[model samples]
Target: MCKSRILLVEGRRTVGGGQIMSRRICDVLSTNYDIAVFLPDGESPLAELLQDYSLHRYPMLEYHSGKKGVSDVCRFIYNMWRTCRVLRRFIRKEDITVVYVQAPSLLPVVVCAVAGMDVQIFVHLHVVHVDRKVRLLLNVCLQQKCVKKIIGVSDFTLQQLSLKNRRKSVVLYNYIDDCIKKTVSSDTCEKPVISVIADVMRIKGHHVLFEALQSSALNVEVLIIGRIVEVDYYKELIDKKYSFQYTFTGYVNDVERYLEQTDLVIVPSVGFETFSLAMVESWGKGIPTIASDLGGMKELVENFLPQYAEILLFSPGNIEELKVKIETILNHDILYREVSEKVHEVAYNNFSKTSFRKKLLGII
Candidate 1:
């Protein structure tokens, strides 16, 4: 039997959690399927990451940030139509049997269905909060004949979809690659080093973490890694005075290296997150994480992996509670070590590449 030809569509040009997940999926599925990627026009950081696969570019597929005005809406519709036309041509040219779209974007699903090809369409939902217009678009896309499955990064995300679409929705957790697992460091610093690996956005709760750091009496080193998405917010954070020593490395390539050196990782997201890839990455490196007890972070820590609940979680936006948790992790050595080992065990058993591949292949 011949292998199926799969075309993965990513509508974004920037590097984000969704793009990263798509890259990993492409890397793994390429060995079993004929894989190609349809990305937005212009430079994409994911291109360097997915060097093994064939990349197809189409204009007007780049991500739209912030609120859209009347003109923006008109432009969006025009661009979407152009994108659909390009996608239709590519599907016919490549003879793709499966169309895997990263994130719950309506254009790709609708395009795949309208392309009039005998292909299975799989849409992955990574965020819970969708605009009203996007939600309506998704409903229309779900009704399409080609859309076969809707995969959510977490159960929280799946539940946000319309009830009619829930029947086809499945929860598929993100996985950490072998490179991250193999590079687990057994070393530790003299003072506790807390790291936050996320884009510098207000929703990520970097300001809240900074407040906690200021209030806490413990001596610690903070490493803020990732691109500065919000310039004013990041400026405000840097300008504010805090007792704890910290450094903001604006988007480093070697995330595993930072994870290896850190004593603990913190995910203080105030907004709804589909899944915290940083938490999983930390666990892969045998490091425990202190994440806000909200949305998917709460679901992962409190429900999915309850063993490390007590030490590895804090209420979202609670400065005092966050301070206490940081203090506990820094002051208590035995508890930290125990939680670190347990979380690492859970990550290896469940979130490893092998486990993810098995589950994904079963679904396919």
Candidate 2:
């Protein structure tokens, strides 16, 4: 008997949680299906790791942070049309029966390409969009007959869709690497080390974290991991007055190594966050986190560690509240150790690679 064919599509040109999950899906599905990866024509960690697979690249237009012009609109339209045409042809030629689109930006074109075809469409959403226009377009596309399932990284992500559109949706939380859990150690430092593992964007609330740390009397150091996605934002962060010492390690491939030294992880995202692999990975290392009580971060803590939600979550962009949470963890050693152990157990039981692989295989 011939195995089924699956085309996994992703639009990002960078390495993030979404790209990692896409790679995970490919690895798990390849056991029972012939996998083909569709990506933007560029050099990225995902691209390099997936070279051994059937990979296809195209000149894809990505939605980034910028002011849109008429020329930009025209270019996006042309690219969308071209991408749809190319994808439809490829699907037909390759005899693909299942199309798994991993990014929301590529959903419109993918929906159009697979419309009225015999193929099944699975859309996996990683980020939560706040823009009304973007949400409207996504809702329309998801309502199509070909879109068999709308998979959200968290339940909060699926809540953003229309009631009618949500009928075909399911929540499949993202998971951390199994090896990360092994890095957990019974380590403690005199001066607590709080690390924020996210790109330097205003939406990530890096300045808010710095401001909170400055007000605290306790001595703490910060490790700002990931690349500076926005230069202006980084400049603003550096120019601010903060008493706590902080270092920026621009785009480190081995993030777990840094987590090993960290006592606490802070996720201060003011904007919509569907899910945070950083927080999960930190937990897998038996590290406690104080995350902004927004979107999926709140959902994860409230659902998984409900008794510790008050200790783990802070109001988004609230300097005083965040400052208090950080101090609370650092001042009490017992509380810190207890939360750490609980998070490690949660990560192992809920966010393990084995659990994710089993569920994904069943979903597809």
Candidate 3:
């Protein structure tokens, strides 16, 4: 059989969910199909990532949001045009069979429409791009004529997508590797550790986490391990000098190292997560999570894996609810231990590398 060529179009170079998703696709299909990925510029963790896999990559114009105004808008448009040019060239050179658009921002649907190549197109909608109220673009490229499949990381995401395009897309729950599982100890001891591992974003609801920690009676030290999305947002919060017993490890490269000692990882987010890699990784490592009952993660924590019931779910942006959830876990050792016992079984069955690879093979 002739190997089908797959091209992934995503924006960033760093190790985030988008890159992780692309890696899985490459891992699954590379054994049977030729694969190449398109990143904004050839300067990302992906460049290093491609070295380890049977994969290839390319660079287009480096698109960075300039100052927030008309200037930024102009810069975005110019970069996208350059990206479209790269797509034209890449299609002719690689003889690609399918192009996967990773995000609405970086890989604009317009490029694929103009490629004029008979390639299958998949839009992996990772977020509800339209703001809180739900907005969408009517680009004909997304219409049935151009695009073939639309993949939403969660069922909640599919509902949001249905708001704009009345098309029914596939819901593929994000997968985690087995390494996320925690080692089972024959002897167990109660350790005091509770944390929220997520990027510092307004919608992610770090404030709710802060409130939860303040309310907890346990000596709960929140290990904050993620990069800042907005400088002003970080500054506003930092200037106040937060009150929780918090160790702000602003953007650590080694999260797993922190996870090793953690008793619980909190994903108290107020916004929509296409899928929380933090939650998946923590669950895999045997560390239980407490998350917000918001968008996609609700399905990830509640329905898919009920064994992780310790992952207390609270209302989105609700500080009081988060406070109660955290207190219950901190106050009860037996409840935490009961859920902890099931972590290895859940992680191995749901997120093992072997299992994830199998899922990918089936998808591709």
When sorted by TM-score, best at the front, the candidate numbers are 2, 1, 3
Per-candidate RMSD vs. true structure? 2.4, 2.1, 3.8
lDDT of 1 at 221: 89
What are the per-residue Cα lDDT tens digits for candidate 1 across 1-364?
7778888887676687777889889867876888888877776677766667888878763345544457757666766687777787778777878888885554443454456568888888887645676667676777576778888889988776778788888998999884343332223446778899999999899988889989877778899999999999999998978898999988776888888778888999997787999988888777878898877888899865786687778878999988888777667767766777777777877787777788787777
TM-score (C-alpha) between model 3 and the true structure: 0.83
Model 1 error, position 252 (Å)? 2.3
lDDT of 2 by residue, 1-364 (tens): 8889999998878887788788878888888899999998878877986787899887786665434456656766977899899998999899899999997788888888887789899999887776666778889989888889988999999987999988888888887775354333333566778899998899899988899888889888899998899999999888877788899999887888898788889999998788998988888888899999999999999999999999999989999999998888878877877888899989989987788878888777
Every candidate's lDDT? 0.78, 0.85, 0.65
Question: What tens digits encode model 3's per-residue C-alpha lDDT throughout 1-364?
Answer: 7777777776666666766777776776677777777765655666665555534444443434322455545665676666666677767787877777775565453444345567777777776654432233423345655577777777776675544354546776666654545553313534466666776777777777776666655555567787777777777666765455566677665677888877777777766676787877777777667887777777876765665544467778777777777667656667666666565456667766666566556655
User: Among all windows of ten consecutive residues in candidate 1, which has the lowest summed lDDT?
Assistant: 178-187
Model 2: CA > 4 A from native: 66-72, 179-187
In angstroms, how far off is 40's CA in candidate 1?
A: 0.5
Residue 128 alpha-carbon offset, candidate 3, angstroms: 1.1
Residue 288 of model 2 has an lDDT of 90
> Which candidate do you rate higher for lDDT, 1 or 2?
2
Q: Which stretches of candidate 3 lie over 4 Å from their true place?
A: 50-76, 106-115, 131-135, 163-168, 183-191, 240-245, 305-311
Q: What's the lDDT for residue 237 in model 1?
A: 94
